[model samples]
Target: MATAGKAVVAQQQTNLPFAYRQYSAAELKEALRKMYLIRRFEEGAEDAYMRGLIHGTMHLSIGQEASAVGICMPLSEDDQITSTHRGHGHCIAKGADVKRMFAEFFGKTTGYCKGRGGSMHIADVAKGNLGANGIVAGGIPIAVGAALSAKKLRTGKVVVSFFGDGANNEGAFHEALNMASIWSLPVVFVCENNGYGMSTSIERSTAVRSVADRAAAYGMPGVVVDGNNFSAVAEASQAALARARRGEGPTLIESKTYRYRGHSKSDRNRYRTKEEIEDWMTNRDPIALFEAELVELGIIDQAGIEAVREAVRKEIVEGIEFAKESPMPDMADRERYVYTEAA
Candidate 1:
């Protein structure tokens, strides 16, 4: 696989959208479908949030769909992942039920966490997703713990930890990496460096030029991938996952991506310029790039793309309706799952 910088240059030079030669036409179609689903789902969630249907603020993964789908596609259902606050795409890509996710957003009793986890705390233990964390780097230690469990039990499964560049600066990130490395745990630390942490640009907060550089200190391969390119992310993830399953230890993958939305609903995006956002939105959109690739490669036509879009739109509509129809948790049941009872 090419280095991150090289991959970017290669994509630009070749004017090719993606390097998905290994994917069959049907698989590519499904990948595009999932990306579209994530896009539409996040858009629908934001609309619900604005209309007061969603109870709390949500961090949308509008532009980083490829980073989520590409990484998860290579793994089996038994493998696990820990997600970040901006993790709706991760959950969806890992096979989350959109209706239930919408229910969770609506704070209904039928939702994940029985509607208690809200946007950031969603988890599907049966899906092998530990949870989406609210605190920065909070899930890293949890992922390491899961990896330790897998190692001790000899489950032969790998755990992936997804965090942002900002989380790399946290104490939990360091501690977890150290312990995982020493114990040769089956985990992959994926850092989604989306140019900024909250409102502050990475250049202002991070001392190193690349987050992957830090992986060398832990004695594992550190790879950087063009996060917008699905093929790049998949290739890097496949390597890291192989290493983890082989009992070699953890690997750190830095997917260099960007989020189109402000850090959250409250952010006015005063830190970045409209030009920069436009550049990424118009030119480097992961969905647009992959769509163009699929069309150009004769894998999918305009009609195919429209079919996928229409289907995704209908799915989002049904999901929202499901959330609207679902019942909210009753007052008596409020404390049921909040804490451990006397059993």
Candidate 2:
């Protein structure tokens, strides 16, 4: 009877999802909170932009919250990431301050880049978010360089480069992956395949069926996960991180996610059908899916979920207010950070 009970317990433990089995209840709850924060932050940014409080346009990662949070779940504060134009979720996932993010949108000196980076160039170096790049595949090589540095210095740090599917075809992408593989750099290339890159779909652009398949050419592990499912992404991430930490070559993770909003604020979104958009939003929302799992696992109740939502709402409100009240960069200092100052 004892042996039978042990087998049953082992089977039950094996059946639990990677995240549920690996993380504490508090950690899982915190991951849920970060997902909420990402969703609410983007929505708040959209509202502020519409109100003319934010000057430049912003790319919102409204639906792909799980990919960002899950991929970063296993990473340490000392680890690094390079983000794309659609990188707000990545920033929040890597522990960026929402108030500073909002301030950057408002072009305030209190922003991450001191009002220089704005939407697509926010960088928190101390927290290891190298920066978000506006150029396609621009951050890929930078991440490779950072990874090389880590390997050379024996830092034991892993780097994640988050780019869209469109960047997969770029020359830099291929070159960076090839270099990372040859050197066995501690890096993970994350392709957040959100179906459309600007207006063209992946089918219309890339020849490959899936981005992960491309990893074989570079001689690394290629993983595909349902980006909406937090557990799946986290599972893949945990494995990839372990591989990199063991000094194995880089891994490629293709997160099959969808962005509910247009590619950018200026995007007309005429390429995809509204039915498709509604379907993803209604059925496969990352936040909703994660919440359901949390409840099913007995990790959190409805009241706890509502409390998280309320906290995010309050945080978003306070962050926007902070940005609104912050001082903009002085005109006299326009050329301050433009050129390196002499010692």
Candidate 3:
């Protein structure tokens, strides 16, 4: 690794376009572990996809790990989170088992959805992950419904709805936000604004300058944070979640982030330039940024960082092997879940 002072000076001199909070050493290290786990898990999934071991289309949250980890930091195991198509990181950060996640990707019986839902539909209700939605804004309403339930039941549980910038244009987003605001539902609408909603850039498709601006219309607090910065994201989420828990109502948090991979495996680079992607990856990699900060802050040396990386790598490899060795679903039960089981 480069010298600690060099990293600190370079980062300090560089002007960050948005506001972010500083992190404690312990918090930084924990965040790094989670972020690294997400990265390695995503990489494993990509490798499996490329090798033809996984079927069906998948969306990898390769560059958006920080957003997932940071947002979930303030959440409880009992607090629900609804996820979009690119939601593996959300599940991982929320304490979903990586072995089961790999099994889901590989379509094994031990998968979260029993191999039925695959990558885009994995869910663990007990872990507070409602599920990942294939539709752009499908999870929004579900999260709202969960928040409503929590309020009615007086469970003191908050719901975090994770969606992409593209989902903002959907009618579901509007309806859910409006309803949540009026009811003062315990929900946080987190928009991972990765610049583009698939092929259409935010500039071309959206009327508002920022997604956070849309919160004013719904009569709630809207915050725009540096999604690549874990500290910034965590602080923003903490505030938003606090408001939700206090019954202050929903919050719209727009996390400005970037997706390193194409929208999916099928997407080409026709919509955006290689230079733009390269710039984001080189300058704003969440993992790299956090690593440097940890070094600069004297939280962890490069060796300690490497140890975390190696551990995460080992876990991912073990998960993949476990998924491969897991059994396939019994063919006789194919007709079972299609109908509701009798009590």
lDDT of 2 by residue, 1-343 (tens): 1123232212334677777667777788999999999999999999998988888788999999999999999899999999999999999999999999999999999999999999999888889999999999999999999999999999999999999999998999999999999999999999999998899999999999999999999999899999999989988988888899999979999999999999888988899999999999999999999899889877799999999999999999999999999998999998998789998
- Candidate 3 per-residue lDDT, tens place, 97-205, comes to 8999999889899999999999899888889999999999999999999999999999999999999999999999999999999999999999999988889999999
Candidate lDDT (C-alpha), each = 0.89, 0.93, 0.89
Give candidate 1's error at residue 283 in angstroms. Answer: 0.7
- lDDT of model 2, residue 170: 96
Off by over 4 Å in 1: 1-19, 339-343
Q: Which candidate is the best by lDDT?
A: 2
* Model 3 error, position 254 (Å): 0.2
For residue 49, model 2's alpha carbon misses the true position, in angstroms, by 0.3
lDDT of 3 at 62: 88
Model 2 residue 166 CA deviation in Å: 0.6
Greater-lDDT candidate between 2 and 3: 2
Residue-level lDDT for 21 in candidate 3: 28
Off by over 4 Å in 3: 1-24
Cα-based RMSD of candidate 3 = 5.4
* Tens-digit lDDT string for candidate 1 (62-98): 9999999999977889999999999999998888889
